[model samples]
Target: MKIATILGTRPEIIKMAPIIDEISKRNIDQIVLHTGQHYDEEMSDTFFRDLDIRTPDYNIQVGSGTHGKQTGLMMKGIEKVLLDEKPDIVLVQGDTNAVLAGALVASKLHIAIGHVEAGLRSFDMTMPEEINRRAADVCSTMYFIPTAESAINLLAEGYSRKNLFITGNTVVDACFRHLKIAKKRGIKEKSLKELNIDKMDNILTLTMHRAENVDVKERVVGIIEALKELDDADIIFPIHPRTKNTLEKFGLFDELNNLEHVHIIKPLGYLDFLLLTSASTLILTDSGGLQEEAITLSVPSLTLRYNTERPETVTAGGNILVGSDREAIVSNARKILDNKNFADKMKNAINPYGQGDSAKLTVDAIEDYHARGLLDIVAPEDIMNSFKRKMKNIREDISVKDFERKENALVHMVFDGKNMQFPTDELNLNGMVINYDKRE
Candidate 1:
């Protein structure tokens, strides 16, 4: 069985590394597709090299554009590839234009769609990612939810229980894998020494790339003011390309650069950033991945966003949502810095994400589904037991029998803003009508 894995952003690359590693180990014929959502080599190519991942088989080079333009171009590009390769399954991770486009095009071709990080919801529809994830879930044939809460979210959204699996977050697997590599390479020690900073110092790791935060001038200024309040602490910020552009556009780059304690540097590779995150005293960011990583490492964190898709981290006492309100941001930072007891409590808190075996479970699920198609290979019942035994934490009621054979179905799709009506009896490729305009 051929598997097509589609990715675009750095976050997607980081999250998908372990799954790619597992697929390679199994000698699966997998193809990697790059959408170029982050087209810069520093942001994209560095990740593949750092993670030791094979170069992408196809690079559409969609790069950056408006939401509609990006997704539209990606959909067109991915559809041609799907037609050429005709893979049995197309896998996409997280909520990006790439995932949405992959899901859309594969659904049109009746290819099996597997969403790696399915069922995540910040419940804030204003965020583009929320819409992308929800829409992708609707078209997915396999849903690999990272937590029980995520599974519950999918079920509540009326997804088929048979399609869902509660594999832990693959970030845990990637973090564990990369952190070991980082330690072996002495990355953390070397990074601190190079930066002229000590590991024991009060360090605030900041990352802000969310469009909602940086795109708005008022919000960006507020965040800067809040950062100024923590001028006494060492701030290590791995500036995202978009964030840097937005800062410059808003005329706040000079102010931020002049901040004595704020050390703004170009984006780091996965190992460097992971090492930096591991050694930080506190993490302040708008990134969802960082929130989870901070929780895994037991570091105190403050999220600049008003809401998070990963609320488990906050409930576990590892992260606080401070938004971009200057007072709130400053207050929370001061609270975490001044209250040693609070920081210690956050450090000791249990990570709700999970221990690192998510990649193995994900690959096992994929292989089990593929093997089910060959009657000459193994009995379905035995395959089910083997999968269950291998992945002990799998839901008790989920069985290998849940895997469905794929065939074309009638689809209702909207091109542009209009719903195109076709003869009802002529249902063929992916019976579901996809409303692309719903995102617009």
Candidate 2:
């Protein structure tokens, strides 16, 4: 069966790389579609080369815009590609606008959708990613969830268990697969030399690009102030293009740049970034993916956000939500950086993501479900049976006399173009009467 994998942005590429490689190994027909949500070469093209991902078969180039405009353009572009490709299933990873657009178009076209990293909820209606995640999950036919907690989230939302597969997370697979390659290529050493950072120096990798944080001048200023307070560790800030623009706009770029400890660098390739994260003493970011990566690398992280979609990281004892409050951010960072016992405790926390075979499990589940004809958006046998039982309960709850007494009530009903008579007497009612007794 043919598959269309839709992805946009750096995180989606990093997470989907292993699954793409897996499909290639199995000789499956797969089409890679890029929406160009991240238009910058550093954010998009470099990931493909870094991860050894095949070049995208189609690039919509829908670039940055208002959320509505971006999603609309993506839907229009993705619709055209999906119609031309007409693949058996469309696969989308993460909660970018590309995922939402791909899922919507595929759902309308009656193509099965497989959602990777499904069942995430921040429960904050204000966050755009939360909306995208919920919408994508609603349109999906198959859910490749990352953890048991994610499965719980979906089950609570009334999704079918049959369609949910606990495939750990592909990020775990990507990190494990690439870290070895990064070391083999000596990317870590090269990155350290390029940044002029000695191996013995404490490194705090900072990444903040979420709109909620950077759009507000006060919040951005507060974060920069917190970075200033953390003078002991050298901060390696791989600045996103948008974040950099915002910093410049707010007139805080020079102030942050002048700080001796904060080293603001442009975005690095995925391999180089992976190496940097692996070597970091601590991580501070608002990125959900970085929360996962920090834990995977055994690095303690302070999330510069009020809430997180990846609460598992916090629960696993490797991350903390410090928000944009200057005081909170500084206190948390100092606690991790100054206390060796606390740092080691976080570094030794068990990785909750999985054993890095999630790609195999995900692809295998897709093939298994497809072969069993379970990928289509049709009711499964179990659901049909439950529906039948509910219908039977409704039928038994109504009395023939009560039905006959109603104005324009009928003694028969048509089902599947067949007329079926209602029970007219006690004998015909079978055992449906709730209180009927033979002695009476």
Task: Please report the candidate that would top lDDT against the real structure.
Answer: 2
lDDT string, candidate 1, 1-440, tens digits: 88899988888887888999999998989899998888776456656876777889899998888999999999999999889998888999999889999999998787888899898899999888999999899888888888766776775565645567778898888888888877777654344457865444888999998888999999999999998989878998888877898899999999999998988887776787887888888998998888988988778999998899998788888889999999998888888889998879989888777788888898888888778762122223643323211111122322222211211221123122243322122223232223211110
All-Cα superposition RMSD per candidate: 11.2, 11.0
Name the best candidate (by TM-score): 2
* Local distance difference test values of all predictions, in order: 0.78, 0.82
| TM-score of model 1 (CA atoms) | 0.80
After superposing candidate 2 on the true structure, give the runs of residues whose Cα lies further than 4 Å from its correct spot: 43-47, 187-192, 379-440
lDDT (tens digit, per residue) of candidate 2 on 1-440:
99899988888888998999999999999999999988876556655776678989999999899999999999999999999988989999989899999999999998999999999889999988889999999999999988767776876575755577888889898899888878777654344458755464799999998989999999998998898899989999888888999989999999999999888887777777887888889999998998999998899999998888899888899999999999999988888888999999999888878889999999999899889977666644643323211112134434545533542232322122232322332223323422211110
